[model samples]
Target: MSAPTHTTTSEPFDFARAASLLTDAAARAGAAIMAHYTGGTEIEIKADSSPITNADRDSQAIILEALKVLAPEIPVVSEELASDLTASLGPRFFLIDPLDGTKEFIKKRTDFTINIALVEHGRPCFGLVYAPARSLLALTVADGEAVEATLPPDEAGADLSKLAQTRLRARVADPDGLTAVVSLSHFDPETEAFLSKLNIAERSSAGSAVKFLELARGRADVYPRFGPTMEWDTAAGHAVLEAAGGFAVAADGTKLRYGKTEAGLRNPGFVAWGRKAGASHH
Candidate 1:
């Protein structure tokens, strides 16, 4: 069967509804993570050497169920389920990371996140990143459209109704200075050499998909990854960054696309930078 179609009608973007659902989902996932965080759960390695826990599976199930209820028609491609559905997706779908930063979570750090992105025609049209422990939610819809909200205590469990909205924008300090964001966990020697060549002034280290959020909020300038990442790892972040006048592209300058192959979902090394960087670098 074909995947369900996403709504294109102009029926007002439901920021409130989206926030509530995402916050609740994040909180639910967070609780699961906390349970494992106390340190009794076993950890197993995926073929890629990534760690997986009961928290990841439980959280993914929670997010998947919540998303289905919130937007039943939208198809979902969550990291936990990608292997099963990767070959069957349609033009538009939701890319989700239920427990992004499982490594961090296992380490008892608060760097994990719940990521959701709306991908249409191989590009993200909307994106949301929820960090449950921090009670933070970052959202971007289109160009000049973005909001950062905090989840309320009362509705912390998938409540789609109590998110307090706040505005967010990219921070451009020098406009000419090269600021780069590199991975805190996946940094490599080659990526370091690349940044050195650019003469970057400010460097930021963030875990999970929050690197994309940093770029979206203008907190950092550029992100260059020479290693590997799956489509789900960067799709949502790419959407938010693109909406904020930034983009994540292959090192060769092609826009990142998803649903390519199953043998390897690892993405090519890419550079993410703002509109100004495009003029100077690309």
Candidate 2:
């Protein structure tokens, strides 16, 4: 008997395809969240006493299931479900925050977001942040291209490929022209003290990771975060900013990296800056 011949034609890695899938997954999660947003937003307290809504759980389920199909080989460390990020993660993994701003969500604010990112070698390499209320999506497709896009206002026929795309650019801003974006609800004096030293031209406040977008788009120059945060909180936003030619750094000026198991997924005080925003941000 003749030996059986193997004819396998595997496709090359498709960055665009992966990005589209991730974006579509975010859209689905967004829809899941919207369903609850329209109904009663019953709130539950986590061990941390932070708010958790049905929307968060529902969205997490949608994203996690999609990720299983999208990249079954990799593990996911999601904020709503993961108990230990370091113990649960590898050099390559997915990090997600199904609903990043639950307080904002409860308050009926649009700043809440759905975060998804791929972390490799302690760096956020690709990510997508979908603001379902705003119908905005931002991502990097592993091509070093970061973009902010919009799906159709109509959610039912959402298509990531049909997204209107605008490549992001972190514009240069000197100290005198710099505007610092701070957390609207969590801003502390330490962050204010840090910003004061820069003498930034303006101060603006917003909730959640949307500040990352402000920096990535040149709408703002710097973000000083001095309070507690988690890896999932920043990873997706960090990937988008880095791909847009900007960076986030600790107060000590070390570039922020992911998978800090010792810290229990918590992040230290840090400053995120746009391209050429100046050394003061560090």
Candidate 3:
């Protein structure tokens, strides 16, 4: 089914309820990931030689099943299941990256995560990223409310009310004193050249969508990703940052758009930054 392209402020889309359901869904996926994390799952080679495991497959299965029940009308585009699925997608769709950091997950690092996003008219309308190994969960519906909470031991039965919620806010970047975040797995010279243009105070590298988390939480000021990326890789993070009053813009200073049919689902260079970054840093 086609998704709604726009909603008025009074629209009946309940973000809290969506966040609740996504929390449970992500927690389930995370559980599936952790099960194989310590249990030693076999890895297979994808066409690109990237690592794939039962954890990735099983986690996507759980998330796709959950999303089907949550929003039956919306289509789903998942990384692991893409091979068997068709390429055509609706204006609105659910995107999933059951295991975002395969290398990190394989090495038992805590940088891995599970990502889910709802795209409407080429923009992220809802997003959730759960770092199961790190016990951190982020949720946003692009309704001007974004939050990050700790996943309780019983994530499946987490008390949505009792969860300590921190409303995400993007802090202003002192351009000359900014803490820049970069990719840990795929650092390239292009990114360095981009950073040199900025007056940065420190540089940090991380894996998966955690870079978005840093910006949303007001811990970091900017994340300039110049290397290759897919639509799924940035959609969830983009939604979360937007909800937190931040932005993900292209090289030409335009907001990032999704659902690229011509580019084969790949993304161009984009900079993820806080709300005050553009006004103050530029």
Q: lDDT for each of the candidates?
A: 0.72, 0.81, 0.82
- Please state every model's RMSD to the true fold in angstroms: 3.2, 5.8, 2.0
lDDT of 1 by residue, 1-282 (tens): 353333455434354576556667767776776667676578889876788888788888887887887788778887877666436566667888877888887777777787887766676767878776676777763334667777522224745444566566565546556678888899999888888777577898878888887877778888898887887888877776776777777888887777665535568888887655335554
User: In terms of lDDT, which candidate is strongest?
Assistant: 3
Superposition error at 175 for model 2 (Å): 3.4
Point out the worst 10-residue segment of candidate 1 by lDDT: 3-12
lDDT of 3 by residue, 89-121 (tens): 878888888889899898888888888998888
**Considering only N, C-alpha and C atoms within 3 Å, which residue pairs clash in candidate 1?**
20-160, 21-160, 24-158, 170-217, 170-218, 171-218
lDDT of 2 by residue, 1-282 (tens): 121121222323355776877777787788888878778778999998899999999889878877887878778888888775558465677889999989988988888899988777687877888888888888897546799987533344356767778999887776566788999889888987887778588888888789899988888888989899998999999999988998899878898978888788789888898896344545
Q: Which stretches of candidate 2 lie over 4 Å from their true place?
A: 1-14, 86-88, 152-157, 277-281
Error of 2 at 76 (Å): 0.3
Give the distance in Å from residue 31's predicted Cα in candidate 1 to where it truly belongs. Answer: 2.8
The C-alpha stretches of model 3 lying farther than 4 A from their native spots are: 10-13, 84-86, 153-157, 277-282
Regions of model 1 farther than 4 Å from truth: 1-16, 84-86, 141-144, 152-161, 173-176, 262-264
Query: Which has the better lDDT: candidate 1, or candidate 2?
Result: 2
Winner on TM-score between 1 and 3 is 3
Clashing pairs in 3: none
Name the TM-score of candidate 3: 0.93
